[model samples]
Target: MWENKIRCPCSRCSNNKFLCEDKVTEHILNRGFTGAYTIWSLHGEHDVGQSLRSRDRVEPYASNKEHEEYGEPIYDEEIENPYSRMVKDAMGPEVAFNYGCENESRLQRLYMSCKTAEYMTWHVQNQSDDGVLKHPIDGEEILSRLNSLPDLPFGTKCGDQKISGYGVSHNWVKNSILWDLPYWHMLFIRHNLDVMHIEHNVFENIFNTMMDVKGMTKDNLKARQDLKVSCKRPELELMKNNGKIFKLKAAYTLNKEEIKKICAWVKQMRFPDGFASNISRCINEIDYKFYRMKSHDCHIFLQRLLLIVFHDMVPHSIWDAITGISHFFRDLCTTEILVDHMEALQGKICETICKLEKIFPSGFFDSMEHLPIHLPYEAKFGGPIQYRWMYPFERFLQHLKKKVKNRASVEGSICEAYIIEEISSFSSWYFEPAMRTRLNRMPRNDDGGDVDSQGRLSIFIHFGRAFGPLEKSRFLDEDEFYAAELYVLMNSEEMLPYIKMFDEIIKGDVVHISEDELEKVRDARFVKWFKNYVATRMDEIDPRILEISHGPGRMIMSRPDTPLEPVTTVVVS
Candidate 1:
């Protein structure tokens, strides 16, 4: 009876635990299927592929009017004028925006639950006494302002239905739904910024300006025009050349040859596996501009590679400022943050931006540059920037986009695909421990197959899967073959005892030898002496010892493969 039993796929069990056949049927009857398990792979039913005709077929039933009347907006058609509709919808009253419950119900959930009630008053206990800012909750000025401000009356509107002559109340247009909570304003870390996008924007501004890409650069014609009026820099002011207005080359912007050189360097670069994407493809040699760089690519550039590529190429002042900003971001995005250090970082970042302000034009300092000032404060309370970033959500959205098989009915297709994925995920929990699931899949570079666990030499173990095609097989020279054998034996765990024995014999032979000289003697003659020593122990020895004594073979397979290092190549224009 135990041999025939299987895990139940009911809502309660969710394929996580096993149950007897009778109990499983009873559970299913009582609780229904877990994530609607239609594919019964565990019950000897394979997932047969549906015909193309059936898969592509769009089954239509209800109209938009009928959906509205029935109090269901299950299926929404693709918005034709999405931007305009979005703006119009955003401007409408908030009375229709309520989804789960009324304001009273949400407040009750926050205050009534013993677990939640403790969290509501956590700030009062956790707030710091020292002047140093560790978390947002420790912020004195912000908290004082929040506490001082009078709460807006419930249902108060700004411009929609103005009670007084003023369009807004204390610069606030409308009362936020969150303000309904008594403790909303008092809570620390009320708003958090997405550092992923912030990094991308900051990198975009700096890269474009330094490279002086046409139209995209912050050091454009209009910027120079503004520079003339705003600042007293005579060199940067626009001059009328041959009846056409022309801007002089700024000291910060790179020349044509410098841009070409940078682009060429980025093109020929390679990266380690899984480190970053093919950034070389994004480089356009003809135009000398980077294109189609994703957020992660921007992240890689800002955090790691930005300074390396631009170290000595740009002017000294510009490079110094850029390095300061780069180091600031690299430190900010660290997984483990020290609270005591955030106060210093906050001041350092402000100084770094000021240095940038001195070098670059006025237009260079956009909201992205200014946003970093608040980030350290947020990071103080928010912890690591990874939790607040949009990288995971962006990847998940990309995954959802791949699920669009039927583009005509995209919503329907995503829904169906999502349901199927849920079913598979629920069923995967019951799979055997040894079986490969999504979470337990092998990494790209795992090439070591199963080996004898008992008495094998560690030197025979291979790691990092071979990449590219094998070009040819050839025999190594006498010296090359010996070198390989020595390397393997030196690194092998099984050969450690023999190596130590040889070392002791060496120490005895050269009584007055120094440490460095003794190491050289061991490296030079250890292999030959070890081989002869192993041969003497032929009567009772492991097979591995005999094999090592014979040494490695001359023949080896050659392949032209290099690590995809995190780098880019450049083509000279």
Candidate 2:
């Protein structure tokens, strides 16, 4: 069995405790049930006997030619690894994705399952132990010891592929579909290590560091010193002119007063409606206020709630690092984002994490160390991080469990629920969707009529960030609609003829508008908005690559007359 990473047991396996598709279906089909739900009739299953039966006449059917016919050996060394050729020939190169398994025993067992090995493999006169790379491989030539043989009796049916296993038992070939191995391995990469686990652990470490829990509060003298120096203000007006730079104890971690102040600040700040009432639920459930937050308060505290509570009590670097990591993950989870952009964001994020090390107690880095290594790999896999994440699956599992109305046979209840749900969904595809999906209800007199399903558009007509939203989009202006049509045409590289066609269509218009004039107006408006946004929120801009005006009138103003973090005029010529 594979190593399960998440806390979930059922997410990795099923009610029958089966993780591997091959094993579970085979076991079920062997029961000889001829029902519609039997393994032979399972449409979702690729490896069922019925599915494989049709593929026997295919051109790429499993080749059984001897190793001598190909003139290429599976193993490099002739004397050792003799069974490697026989194993490859039996397994077939089509299934070469998991030709190398993470567990050497499984790979060995696979080899041992083959009946073609004529030479001595494992346990050859006690020269060495069975072949395994227990330690990290670095500068070693002596990997060839031997593969362990299977404990199964010699003449069992599937002990050899030649007997029947190919088309009679499985479709999709004997290829390793485990973890997208073919895609990653050929590119010199292994399967993606689940990033959700790494992120949760890292966030947990950050939360623990802030909470200043036991065992972690030990004197990390260098970390303390580094944090103190980084956090130290250049001067304090309250401290007299005689005041000198000095280290503060518990500089990296918050003290009691600071926690109280943070709580006071959070309480004072206005929040969304019912937020105050909702927070009361936390205290009522946990028996403690946010001021007295506990160390064991899970990943959500670090991921979401921390931003609301954190204030000036902590150093800006520590705050930025925490927020930066949170932002990085949130960005990765977005479906519309490009992979190249994410990889770029990952680099900037790594820099923030490196800065975070300065604030941690010297050896406290080991607490969340694997995070940086894992960050780069997540970008390699296509689509959003949520597709690879366990959170959504874990949440949906609760929904699935809720579908089980009967305690006696939960699986059967779930199947019944799923079939009902599937039938409803399929019916919705052909019928009136608004009635079946959005609900059959009378619209309010005040509500807009015949609204588009994809929500309200901006003032600029058809322009919108996403294809769909909470409210229906409307075409508010004719010019804006044409402008949007032009925009799409330009993006598709067919704008020239469209512009000519538009010019031809608007023959009898009372007011004449040229294509070039419309483009010029749109471009100017876009540039204006871009400049204004940059001017107001330069600090919030990612990577902060904008050049500050350190030229004339850029005096470093101090005190009441001139507010700190001076807002200067940006000259964009």
TM-score of each: 0.55, 0.39
Residue-level lDDT of model 1, residues 26-122, one tens digit each, is 9989999989677666654555467743553543344555676888765566535444554567578655554578533554455443434556555
The TM-score obtained by model 1 is 0.55
Task: Please tell me which predicted candidate would have the highest lDDT against the true structure.
Answer: 1
- Would you give me the overall lDDT of model 1? 0.74
Q: What are the lDDT scores of the predictions, listed in order?
A: 0.74, 0.45
lDDT of 2 by residue, 1-573 (tens): 334221112322323352454554454455443333323212223443754766755523333243456765545674534335535665765743555655324323444422223222322222322221122111012121111222322322322322223235443333566555433333323454555566666665665567554454433445545544555532211122456534345445677676556545544443333222223223322322343332223344555667545546577777777787766666654544554565687687778767766566544666455455554444443334545556677767888999989999999999999899889755554454355352334432222343445532221132211211223223225454344433433443223443444445443342576668766644445333434545787786532112311111221222211111122212111
Question: Which run of 10 residues does model 1 get worst, by summed lDDT?
Answer: 564-573
